[model samples]
Target chain A: MRLVRQLFTVTGLILLSAGYAHADDIKLVNQAFKEVAVVNAKGEKEFKLVEPGTVVPKDEILYITTFANTGDQPATDIVITNPLPNNSRYKAGSAFGAGTEISYSVDGGKSYGTPETLKVSGSAGQTRAAGPDDYTHIRWVYTGELAPGAESTVTFRTIIK
Target chain B: MAGRGYKQILSRLAAVLLLGYMDSSFALGTAANTVINNTAVVDYQVAGVPNAVNASVAFTIEELLDVNVVSLDAANVSVVSPSSGRQLTFLLTNTGNGSEQFLLSVDTALAGDNFDPVPASARIWIDANGDNTLDTLNDILYNGTNGPVLDGSTPGNDAVAVFVLADIPAGRTAGELANVSLIATSVIADAAGEVNNVGAEITAGGDGGVDANIGVSGAQSSAIGTFEVVNSGVSIAKSVLVFDTQGGQDPHPGAVLRYTLQVTVSGASSIDNLVITDSVPANTTYVANSIVLDGVSQTDAGDAPGVDFSDFNISNANTVTVDLSQGGNITVVPPASFTIGFEVTID
Candidate 1:
């Protein structure tokens, strides 16, 4: 009876710690897609996003990141950061997220600012306003709190170099 | 683990192929089979506690198939009637992003030409020595089976020298033209129809089992080389310089007329016993000791062993003869020129 009591106590302690670790429960999923031109049922030509099977130079790719608050409490101060992949250049004005402030980083994610405020040093050591090609990372700050079990998505595009 | 090993082998193959050429700056973009990995992270606060989560995705670049062909010959190759072994040079390049083999062919019956090269005598060869000249002994002939293998993974190693040779028909005349085309087709299966179909994938069809896609060149290219028949002979341009008694440019009596003969040999063959003879003008007197061959004065005496090969009034009276071949002891090759000058007095 003494051994059984000791086992029950250990199991209860493990459950308590598992619950404590679940407090910060946010899940993230990232995906990539390529656009293809196809004719719909009405015979109108339109572009549709699909899985990229064969990519070549200059092909555009769309990246989407979805985050969900799986905890019981609302998640606040939500921030998402993404570093652009190699052999690719960011497309201008492609980042999209509702109710969020989007910014960019040109100094290898050390600092972030809006497109007009961001600066990058040219090869000649002259500082200038950063362009889409100079972007090395992208960040999004959600303005509002995320309710429990609420999911939202942010997207951007890049072209293979 | 197997995939990583395969990728390593593919990279080694690419390096080996890169050694074929010395300089390469023409590659388009990211190399084939390069992996592009992306990851995104989310940081948020749950009940005032900071936490983070991340996700990742990755894919590999595909190979692109393309090729380019150009005529290396600046102009039409000069040939002679009933000639054999005339060559026209060309350059074949693989512009795609993979190592590829090509099937070569020649078409001698092109339209808009003066004549056609003998179809049976037409042949193709690879410039094995890279000298741009067709060396039959060192170059490999295209027997409709073997073709050039070019490496497109790098820039400098992608091009190869090609040559097309043909025989001139016996009845062809001078100034006639014959056009020949060299065609190079990629040996990859179904490559012809899939050309320019961007994003179309061929599974395990590229170098080292990588997938390949069609590029802009459509995987096939051809260029034309022409053969022009030219007469193999000699031509002369004669200009006269007159020294009148008053040093004026008039052919008057007692005035000396110095005639300059610019002789040029054309075509490919050499001539033996190249003897040049000229008669004195009707009313001009022969100027003794005035015969000159190529800026050197010649003795006005019969041909001797060491004296000279020029003499006046030897073959006929009032005639000057200059034996350029030195009594058949030398051969005068074409595309060669000589200047012979002599002065005569007006009667």
Candidate 2:
């Protein structure tokens, strides 16, 4: 019975790897949170990354995600999608990433477009311009291929409501 | 072997269900100032294989609300005519733990005072520049046509200028008083009512939430404005002095007597047609130029220019009269006083 259990565990891991064959090669590293603060007298905001279990409200937070290609070959058409956390609204024009085209989703990732092109249904069934509160997801599409051992980071800001 | 497999499957199912529950429960939006858990999923394609990974973070919302309104400068104001834009000034402060918004309204028909026959329109103003003066440059009017949304303390301690404005109606008689009330309510209150009590936490269970202060002990604060119309006319005091060849040790038959009349005008409004008259005592002669209005000597000349009166007449050397209205141009107003001194002989 013990041998069979071990065999089953190994088989399970092997099948998991098979299903997500390329997932191990492209690793999604640690996720972090940064708060916007005005540390100087100039009324300018400085973003400082916070550890887990930090308190925030009515404040701007930058969510940063790091990913890397650990394989031997280059990775193509790398697209990463992240939903705006609950109780938070996206900060307009705050998405930052090199060589990436940013788009937003208003319908829980069902659709995507720039801020101006996005529309949301109002209470009276009328479609209006999508506000920060209507944002559901943020997507970053890397324009160029990422070579092996290459790491990239994407960040976007959201204000806790 | 079958039993073991069944146990493993059951354990896996439980784990999956528990994870699903946590994702559905904690991933949703919670109330303000409470712990909210959020998770983000990253989906990407690596070498033609689609993959996904997720991470979560928890944060507490900052929640604090305090507010207060300072006492007004004038609780009771006296006005003769019912006019528009009668203003009472006050200071609105946020004394709570967080920033908030306040909704202001006026109740002209509050109990305990005479209600205006027609309800007066009430409005508010902010001393934008903190000069405490309502002017074109510093005053911002908040009216019902376009309601005002006032901010309370948040980024810093906030003291706001608030004006209670009203209009008194015409024909408001003397001793008749009217009351006007200004009430400030928290905009975050669940309903449009007073929020005197501390709100409960959202995680504590039921649906009620905390609210901002409105300058009162409780959720709603109200200040009363009392307007009283009064009729204050004038008051006069009289004194006598006697002189003689012997220095007037007593009131002798040949002693000269001097009488002084002091007149005082009172009340908030101005008055017209102030007339003073005196009957000369028996055997006493009227002294010329003995009458004085605020230290200015007067003559017994009626309608004389620059004489301080339109008419000053002494009839039959026994009656003395002084008219203050100089042909409808001059009259004694409030905060004014005068003394009239004249000499007479005892018969």
Candidate 3:
């Protein structure tokens, strides 16, 4: 009776794989922010790390999100989405995530497209190519499987208003 | 012989008194509207019965009216057109003998001045507290319904503050002089009415009374205080501050930038109807909801009632329009300035 139960379970797994395969476990994500500061060290302007919550006018902040696969099984085709913080503008070409395909949203994440295809309304009421500041959301699509106990981080920079 | 002796003694005593009185009379003649008097009595001891006689002398001082006025511009008030808060200050002194009051008036519609249309509804103010400072909180507003009183107890010791309040007409250029005449008429006793003394000069009366008529009856003094509408207009300056991985303020692709606009009102005046507008530059995107005014974060879409995001607009052009003169708030008074900032990224 136990052997028969084992066979039935194996058959169920095969059937599920033939149809729509789902990830065995969901990935856990952590988010935080940091400001970018330019410090004058010995008369040279150098980039410095500034803790979050101390941003000033004309300062830049970096939004970082870390994802970890804590489940016993691998996670596949993982995707992450983050909204642009208020009172800030996304830095052009600042999004970075290794081994991930990137896309942006300007319509409150309802739709997304590449930078070349995205467009926003200009002051003249004419639709023009969207700039970095128009981006409302950013998404990263992981092409490779996230092995168990694996971790990855995605980051983007924004300027404080 | 007794009659002769009495006559001699009386004559000698009278001569000594007369000489002393003459010296003092000449010396005390300096002041006007003054009175000096002397009395003398003679008695002879030979009659032991004490027969006595008395004499008196009196002098009435003449009256002199001199009105002197000096501009007290110590506050460094800035005169902006179409504004009523501009203060033109002056000091009025009695300079004459006896306590008296003066009627105050302003003439904005004077010739040889730069104002196209003279200031309107001119009013007067007084330093009632005697702090020697012109502050609305502490000073008194004198509308000239009653003239100002200068105390004569201490001649030249009492100086009355005269502040002229008027509305500068709009479109007056900078450096244009608004010549205003401050007519101060002495309040004379038994004057025909509250004397404005406009058509004629007042004279101090041989007698005394308190009416706005200066001259012989009292003595009216006229002084001219000018209100020059300073042209220090509002100025708007714009600059871009940027941050990129490559460094420097020069914006790069994917670099964020802060656009700053500084508005300043220089000179000695205040201005109104201050409106500022700016459209996001090309090749850049405005960060959504990124508008800051005077160090406070503001909303991008909201209604106006207080310090909300409604003070600005992100309409066509991703533009920003700020009205400093919001229903008379934020009037650009001279020596005042404000700053506004927004964010964008280079495409």
Candidate 4:
């Protein structure tokens, strides 16, 4: 019985050799990098509050925007536009770029109105009253796109009624 | 014996070797074996290295294009003086990996050849035209004489740079190294359209070696020193030394002309305690007195002076002056100034 089993095993070896007859000499390897850890820097101008002399009330505030793209791709045509809210006065030349529209509000941020310099088409009537205690968030709209690895920003001042 | 995949792999290897031999396409990069266990061999001979430090220029194109630069700039050059007053010299050379043009100058402030600060000039001439090799112009007359004060254009040539020292005032340090300048400006034509005027600083060194800036085949140079003494006693400081009394002057009663001689090394090397012997002529007489050095007086010969260096000095019978001198640090030097005096009464 043992001789028969050995004979069958030898036959099986022969069959296996006849079946699949190839293999690859495997090898492990290491790779290297060309460059890494890039860094950069930038400069900004000091933000000047329009009312330099007088003491501003608790409701009034002023600050500027500093934006960073941190992403691999850059954003263009970034825009930030803000209108003077109630009780707030828009400082001249405070905007970074030339905006197509310029208007003002005496009542809080609700009603649409033009500056006193622009004439009211009809008689002034029941429009919401704008005052210094109103919230003033400015809007900045842009038309161009920021490129990869680039950044930009905008800013303005406001006083809450 | 070949393994299981031996035939297939052998066929592939044959194809690779054949492809490598017949094709430039398989010459570089991972194109042939892109997937070799994630590793691809990157090998190339190191170029741009021939002109680096410690490299020499040869007669071949490779060596010429890779000529190295050796700067003997005064930055590391210095002159050492034996004593504060001993004369000293600094040597700076370009001993050349190729034709070198340069300047060797000094600001003799303290411890230069002279105790004074002397920086005369940096005017040197080179073979501007590479004429023959040395940039020697026929017009260059060294020291107002013929030839260059220090001129060598041949790759391994050398030149001795001489700087005159100034008078060391009392209580002052050795003047610095300056007023001496050795500059070699090469008029080379670069890749640009015009000729570029470039130069190198050459320093002074005492010996011959690489740092000496002399060259591969090094040669040494030397500086000479001298000093003197004068007795306000006469037109020419009396040679109080009495070798003869014929022309000697008589001071008062039966007195003979006497003098003093001081020898010091103001520059370069120093002399050993040298005994200068002079025979008292038949007409000369000797006076007993002591010689002073470093403010201390010692008898040249005591009637019964115990220890004998008696050979060092002999008086009366035959006058001998042993100027036993030593330099500061190295040997015979200066600044540790030395003066020897003697008194003689004649018959």
Candidate 5:
């Protein structure tokens, strides 16, 4: 009886693998950059994002994560989560993601909510509304399905502590 | 389907019940050579199948070479001419993100001063005893080669007490001022001439194998302390001998009060225009012909032409004046003193 049950389990795993062989459909890339001011031919100063070579405290960094559907099938219920880097604080109102609902987690990545709904425990043991500095992780849930070969990007900013 | 759904709910509830501890903030920002790693995870369903992928990026924090030098003295330090071992206190802090060694220097030939400190007399010392005082016996003298190494990781170990000692030059008059500066520079290799280079980087020059970058302080700082010359060596001792009727020392009517002003001068240089003036006490009458200089009688009139320099009621009413300089013709040298005595009767 045990040999028959193991044989059936092996068959079920093979069938599951064959049915969803293209499970590696999504490709993600993350990069960090900093802004620098440059003067144009018109003598006007403009800010531009450049590779960060030497970042120091109080320097703002832009983090961009790009995702693409590499398979033939559409990807549904796409979610991306990122924890704030160490020695950094999230820049308020800097998260941007089109066609997706953005939420934050003050309790690591366990649960998420809007900034107004999220709460954190203060050093004095009191509960208070979570601010951008209190956010530990950020989550974005794509409402629309991502078609095959479709690509999108999410970006946020943080300041080095 | 119901059993799977129940398991998913239970896992979600367990996750919600979990607590996460927050990291404490770093006062000096991130430490040097710290690698900050960030990763993002993507989860999606393709054809009812679950998949997950993550991407990561990391960078190392460079060292910030910043230093602060401030004079801890509240005001100008008072010193007598020809004095040695006078010290000025200062605080040297490594306001950076990495441990740093500083090379200390002192400059005494500053502008806008009446005199410069004695050449080669300026020295630096570390307050090894933490007493905030310059103890020649306990404090470690800072030789040109041995600089202080301060740890910038914590506030308690980031600052050090410094003392600058110099000798006051002779012949500096009272109210004369001199300025000295204590300079501290980062001892990182090739850190010279990089002051105010806020973003300049030195590869692999910091502690813990980190790159060193010049901060807003330019890796160097200096603070100036002033030394004001004061005539503290000149002193005066006053005494009074009261003689009442029947030679009794009592304060009664018709009693004679003899006041003596003993003037002494000591230092490297003589003082000119040494004048002594005293007013008659209240409810008393000045005794005529009672003025004496160095135990010699002086007339009530202001004598001249090689005569005495003591007189009664000359400058002000009931006031006795004695010109120790003999009308600016002499300089009262050091190790010398003179006595002026005058009498007043009780009214």
Candidate 6:
């Protein structure tokens, strides 16, 4: 019977502890939560290459592209690729802008490898490596995420094949 | 003992019932509390014309330069209208690990000039559980008005609120970006939080740093293109001569000879604010009259166009006028057309 009384007392204590706020008491309280700002938009992007109707030796042919992040939310999954046109050839070592990868194909864009496959090589042997001279196509992808209302630029050079 | 036991049981049961009622009532009241946890009001900025290295190039914002996102503070962003008394349930989140209580505000001072800004007046909403309905809490406003413009002279203050939060998501994202968006009045330029980048940036203090002159504001970005110039020799073609003096045509010494002034921009870079001068050819003789360029009347303005020179003019006509071509105003209106009639005397 004593043990039973002790058990009841414990239960009563637990109930008193577990129960929050008592009757006949008015609780006036206020709390605030913050939200972090998110801007996940990359604006409208544009790219164009105007052809100059001339074939001069060593005269660098330029291709230009404009990029803008329009959405408030930043953008990811950046992929930049371009095939060297038939009448043109890529010059080695020219790539710029957000993030990018350059590839060359001796088979006319049918397949691409590092410069080494085309008889040119980089620090990593057997890799189709390219320099300012053996460029065919240009491509790049951004590794990092672009923030809201952000913009970047890209440019490359080539010669008439 | 039996009677005492029955009374004790009855008293205990009554106490239990009273406690149950109180618990139920307390729970119901606590659940009635409405506070928004998700909010999306945000801000950003673009570097000003002062930041641009190039000067000769006319400054225009084509894009919004963005910063790596850390989080969004939408405590002030609400969907409820102040007058409607609708509830606005806000959700505050951290897109990135960098959590802070950034100030959120609506300033109309920029609207007076920028043509757009956030809405005029808005209120906070409450989400009462079980009710599932939004209840209004506070109406947000910058200054006393619902405009982004403060005065014609000063920079506008942004409508702002401070929100405190613990975490946005489960993990700690160092580079997570956040946003706070709200419904905007048409009178305000921004219906959302800097939706179009048009020179938007984020700083410690919300200043929406942009200055405009003559309607055109600098964009966060701009573009440049280059073209080679191969100037061809001056164009010499047979000249067509006409004599008209208010419907009076006489080329024989008394006739006014009308000539055209033409100019063009052809060099690669675009040029405005130009001034060009062309002397009358030695073979042409004239007294006095008028001149113009491509529909635009010029007393003596820019003579340069992109790529090439398009400047040419005929002055010295007695009553007739000469204007420039694609180059600019060379057309003669009706009243002037009647005056454009004149016969020239061949030398």
Candidate 3 residue A143 C-alpha distance from true site, Å: 99
Those runs of model 4 whose alpha carbons end farther than 4 Å from true positions after fitting are A1-161, B1-181, B184-258, B264-269, B281-284, B302-317, B325-331, B334-337
CA error at residue B76 for candidate 5, angstroms: 2.1
Q: State the local distance difference test value for candidate 2.
A: 0.61
Per-residue CA lDDT of model 5 for B28-128, tens digit only, reads 66677777789998988877666677899887777888889999999888888879978889999987888888999998888988888875988899987
Q: lDDT per residue, candidate 3, A47-134, as tens digits?
A: 3343442222233455555566554555555667677765456777777776788899989889999999999988778999988878
Task: Name the regions of candidate 3 deviating beyond 4 angstroms.
Answer: A1-161, B1-61, B75-77, B83-87, B109-112, B116-120, B123-146, B155-157, B187-220, B230-235, B241-251, B256-258, B265-333, B338-344
Better of 3 and 5 by TM-score: 5
**For model 1, how does the per-residue alpha-carbon lDDT over B1-347 read when each residue is reduced to its tens digit?**
12443244334433433454222333555667778899998888765556676799898777777778899988877788888878888999987766788889899989999998888988899987778878889999998768888777666667889988888888888889999999888777344466546456678777767788777666778899998888768888989999999979887899999999998887756788898889998988889989999889998999987999999998667799999899889899766889999999999
Residue B149, model 6: lDDT of 19
lDDT of each: 0.80, 0.61, 0.58, 0.30, 0.81, 0.30
Model 1 misplaced regions, further than 4 Å:
A1-24, A40-43, A72-77, A91-135, A141-152, B1-26, B128-139, B171-175, B190-201, B230-233, B239-253, B258-342
**Model 1: native contacts recovered, as a fraction:** 0.64
Per-residue lDDT over B200-296 for candidate 4, one digit per residue giving the tens place of the 0 to 100 score: 1122211121111222122222222222221111011225544444555435445654556555444333334544344443454545544444455
Question: How many residue-pair clashes does candidate 3 contain?
Answer: 28
TM-score of chain A by itself in each prediction: 0.84, 0.77, 0.73, 0.36, 0.86, 0.48
TM for candidate 2 is 0.40
Q: What's candidate 4's i-RMS value?
A: 34.7
Candidate 3 Cα deviation (angstroms), residue A126: 90
Q: Against the true two-chain complex, what DockQ does each candidate achieve?
A: 0.28, 0.13, 0.00, 0.01, 0.28, 0.01
**Which of the two candidates, 1 or 2, achieves a greater lDDT against the reference?**
1
**Best by the DockQ measure:** 1
Worst lDDT window (10 residues) for model 5 chain B? B13-22
State the displacement of the C-alpha of residue B283, model 5, in Å, after optimal TM-score superposition.
14
- lDDT string for model 2 (A116-153, tens) is 99999888889999986788889898888878888777
